[model samples]
Each structure stands twice: as C-alpha cells, then as structure tokens.
Target: MKRGVLLVAHGTRVPAGVLAATCFAEGVANRLKAQNPLWENVLCRLAFLEISTPDIYAVATQMYQQEGIRELYILPLLLLSAGHALADLPRIIDDIQRDCPHLRVRMSSPLNDHERLVKIYQQHIHDALQQESGIDALLFVNRGSSYPHSYRIFQQIVQQTSASFPDLKKTSAFFAGLGAGLSRAFHRLEKSGVRECLVLPHLLFPGRLSAQLDRQLKEWAMGHAHLHFRSAPLLGESDELMDVYAKQIVLFSLRRAVQTV
Candidate 1:
C-alpha cells in the first residue's frame, strides 16, 4: 500500500506563526526525501488543527483523492500531549476515518515525551549562553498546559537539564500560570544574586506566544543593572530535529504495519 506522512500542527492566528510551522514541515519532508530514496514517491503534506490554513481533514482527504494513498501517518507537531494532542486530534482522525472507511489512517504520538528533544533544548541554551558571561542561573520557559502528567514530565526534564549542566543554576518556569509569570520568575532568580539569566523556550516554533515572551523580556530588561536576560531561539528547521521527525515517522510506520499483520 502506498503511504504518506501528514505533519499536523496547532497553527496560529498570527501569520508569522503559521509560516514558521509550515516552513518546518516542508523542511522535514525535504530531509526525509533526501535521506531515503524510498520516500520520494511517498506523499508528504502539512495540516493544521485551527487558526491556520488547510485543516486536518481537508488535507488528508485531498491527499487520499489525488495520490491514491492507502496508508496515512498523522504526526502531530505539538509540544506536549495536551487537549489538542489527546482529545482534539483523535476526534479529527476518527471523523476522517468514518468518512473514508477504506482508508488506513493512524495517529501517532505528539513530539512530547521524546528524549531527543532534550538535545534540541540543550543546543538552544548552549548557543544562547555562548554570547553572555557570568551566567549564574538558567530558566527554561515553556507554554504551560493544564494537564498534570505533562507538567510533571516537564519538571522531570528540567531536573535532568539541571543535572547535565552542573556549573550553572537551572530551573524551569511557565508563561501561562502557576507561581510567577516569566518576568516574575526572573525577578525571583535575580533576587537570589544570579548575575545572568537565559530563558529557553520549549516551544517547537516561533508563534504569537513566543513574540509576546520576547517583548516581555525586553521590557523586563530595562534598567536591570545587576542581571541580564536573553531569550533563546525558537525551534526551527535543524538537522537534529529533522532526524527526530523522520525516525518518528519510520517507527510509527513499523508499529502500524505490525498491528495489521
């Protein structure tokens, strides 16, 4: 059966957000085709959940009709397995399956819970910190979710990061809620006599939220004599992240094939 990969992301109402995710998905498809000649004939497409162009079902149906694709892998580009990943996405997949009963559609896990993500996070922090000196604390900021499991996992990852870099003081903060906001988190860190602070976003791509965070950081930095803060680059089209995406698709394919037989 002919197979295809659909990268699904929770797109943004902001134009730049949509463009960033779309560019990343295109890069992923190109990387896969370059590494594996077998993927050349396979259809790779991008779909969005909301606040963007080409909703999930529409894109899937179009690929099915145009490409005669039998097997479809829906890979979500979400960071954590939250409402969108767990509830919304599966409902869409089920709706698509009901409409096209003959189509073999499988929904894979989101980018959450992947160890390889740590490497990407590490690289972001490493690069951002290179330009600064006397960094006493590092704060990794993430778009917070209501899900408890996801939050717990995030905390564990933060602890792991702290352990990895023993020289710097590391902690994780949230932008949405709980405790202090991003700026307040930095204030607390600064009160503890930290010389320099760096914030790394756990988001996969730059979006409206990321832009807001950037602005807040800038405003917070004004007249802060003792402490300096910087925001790391949002996840973009990189070789490491692309490899993770490709491997995830291949692994999902194998698992689905095994389940069928």
Candidate 2:
C-alpha cells in the first residue's frame, strides 16, 4: 500500500510567512525520505489550512486521486491544540475520510509541551540574553486563542517553560487579544518593575505577525526608553525543531504501521 505525508500549516498571505512554512515543510519532506525507511518512497507535501494555495482538502483529494495514496499521515504545523488544530483540521479529515472510506488518515498531535520544545525555548532565551545576566522577566508572545481549553493548555506550557530558568519571571500576551494584549501586558509588567526582558514569539515560522511584533517592540521600546526588550527568533528552519518534528512523526507513524501489521 502506497503512503503519503501531508504537512499542514495555518497559512498566511505574507510572502515571508509562506516561504518560511513552505521551506520547513520541504526540508522535513527531504529529511523524511533520507532518514526513514518507511518514508523512503513516500510522497511528502505541504498544504495550508487557509489563505495560501493548496488547502488541506484539496491536497488530500489530489493525493488520493492522483498519487493513489491509500494510507496517509498528517503532520499539523501548529503549536497549540486550539481552534485550528483541534477542530478545523479534524473536521476536514473526517470529511476526507467520509468521501474516501478506503483512505486511512492519521494526524499527529500539536506540539504542546514537547520536551524538545522546552529545550528550544530555553535556547532562545539564552540566545536573546547572551552575557546579559539577571532574573529579568520574560514575555511570551503568540497569536492567541479565544477557546478556554486553548488558554489553559498554553498557560500550562508557559508555566512549565518559565520554570526552566532560576527564578525567571514571565508574562504571556497575545497579538490578537485586546484586553490581555501586548500593550496591556506591558502595563502589567510595569507594575512588576520589569526592567529588562526577552520577548519570545512562540511561532513555527516568520510571518507578518512576527515582523509586526518586531516593529511594535521597537516602537514600544522607544517610548519606554527606561526599559530593555529583546525579541527572539521564531522557531524556523532550525535543525533542532525540524528534527523534533520528523522524529516525532516517524515514531508515531511507524508505531501505527506496526500495530496494523
């Protein structure tokens, strides 16, 4: 039975975002072929949930109709098990499976509190601070979600990550929310007397949001001359992150394959 790998991401209109997500998908595809025996002859491709070309439904249909893929593995390039990952993707998968009953589809869990992610987050903190040492605060930034469960899961992840450093104070603010947004987050930080801090954008790739974040931080920094805010790099084409994704997917898919055998 032929197999296909579909890598899905929350797409964006920005060229940079598209490039970053696509490049990561391509790299993972190449790595999957070279590294794993199961994926050696597999067709690995990228599809977006929205905005960009080749939406998940379209791509999945094409994979089955053209590629003759009877079995499929879906790797969601999302960070949280929020609206997109938890609901939208699954709905589409259900439809796909309904339409093609013979097409066996399996999806991987979101990168929620993965051990490797914690290590990556720590590395970002170190890279952002460099020799500048202190128990300075940390500002965790993301696109944010409205779902209560999403909020709880993310807060838990933040709490666990912040515990990595010695007495490192941290705050999480969303780019989408108005009340608990970045500006309001700054107000909270001010009360806590956070002088120096590292702003980590919890993102898989660079996009309009990250660029906007950089600009906003610069502007905010200029207004508050007394404070120091540094923005860390997004979880992009780094070897570490890619390896984590590929390893996790391979292990899960291979296990499923064995179970069926």
Candidate 3:
C-alpha cells in the first residue's frame, strides 16, 4: 500500500509561515519521488499546530479516509523535543489513532542530532561571515526553550563549529524565554575583545521571531562600534535539509512496521 507523509510544524498565524512550510513539504515529496520511483505514490500533506490550515487530526484523518493511506508517518518540522514535540504532539497523535484504528501512525525525530542540520547552519553562518568582514565572533542563536536537553544541542553545535574558525570568538544564545538573553550575549562577546558578532537564527522561515532578531541585531549594532551584527538566513527547503527529513521519515516508517509485527 502507498504511504502518506504528514509534515507537522508549530505553525504561525502569518501567511508567510504557511507558505514556507508548504514549500518544504513539496520539496521533500519531490526529492523522495526522484530517489525511489514508487515514492511517487506517497501523499505529502502539511499540518499545523496553531497558525495554519489543517490541524494534525484533520490531515491524518484525511489521509486515512480519503487517500486510502494505510501507513502514515509524521515528520515534525521542529529542531527540539520540547513541549510541542514531547507532550502536545504525542497526545494529538494518540487521539487521532483512536479515531482511525486502521491507520498505522509513526512520528520521526525532530531535526536534531543530524549532521546535515549542522552543515546547514554552518553554511548559513559561513556565508554571512564572508559577506560582512565586521563579524569577528559568531553566535549560533535559536528560539530557546526551558528544557536543558534541548539547549545542550546548541552547545554541541558551537563546539563543533568553533574549531573551524579558531580566530573568531563564538557563543550560543537563545531568543525564547530561556538561557542567556541575546542582548547580554552581544555585550559579552563585545567585552571579550570581540569587535564584531554574527547571530545565526536556528529557525526555518522569516517569522515574527526572525524579524525581531533582525531588528534587534541592527539596533544593537548602532550604539557599539565594536558590536557589528548580521543575522543568518533561515533554513528553507534546501537539498541538504530535504535529505535529512527524508531519512528520518523512512527510518520512522520502517520502525513502525517492525513494531506492528
């Protein structure tokens, strides 16, 4: 039977948010078809948590009922397994499974612990660093969470990337309500004999937080000559990212099949 893939994301109320996520889903589906011709039969759907069309259950049920998809795998378009991925998503999936008993549901890991993810961020910052020579230090910033486990991944990325540019000072900062604030991080980098700083956003699209980071970084640069700043481009539907997502999806599906037996 043909499989169905649902790309679930913590959506935004903004129209741009939906468009970006949909583009990624389309890209993944296209890439999968190219690699495996049989994958052309796979149905790819985008489901949102808050700010987009077709919530999780709606999308899952549609695939189960209308598309005749017997096996469904959820590819969460998130980086960390915080509340949304850990608690909220499982509850949602459980409720959906009750309604569609014949549906074989599985969820892939969030886009973490994957080297391609590291490479994507690495490329984003590397490009920004090349564009602006004023960037003396780099900050791999993210939409943070209270969960310590999630924040540690940022540290790992910093450690791995710091070796590449020994001359530049680097740190990890969070925009959400956790860890060191961005302003504080900027000041620290400046005080540590670092004249320039680049903020790499760990986001997928140009959402509210991404816009705010751009505005804040720009504003921060105006006052301090030693603190020049540039924001990294958000990770869009690139070939590398698609490869990572597709791998996780296939792994999750195969694992689900094993459990059923």
Q: Write model 1 residue lDDT over 121-216, tens digit each, in one string.
A: 777667766777666788888888878887877877777766667888876778774434676687787778887887777787767788888887
TM-score of each prediction: 0.91, 0.89, 0.91
lDDT: which candidate is best?
Answer: 2
Give the per-residue lDDT digits (tens) of candidate 3, residues 43-89.
88889977677899999998899889988878788977788888888
For candidate 1, which ten residues in a row score worst on lDDT?
252-261
Q: Model 1 — TM-score against the truth?
A: 0.91
Candidate 3 global lDDT: 0.78
By descending TM-score, how would the candidates be arranged?
3, 1, 2
Better of 2 and 3 by TM-score: 3
Error of 1 at 174 (Å): 1.6
Task: Please identify model 3 stretches exceeding 4 Å from their true place.
Answer: 255-261
Clashing pairs in 1: none
Per-model lDDT: 0.78, 0.80, 0.78
RMSD per prediction, one decimal? Answer: 2.4, 2.9, 2.2
As for candidate 3, its clashing pairs are none
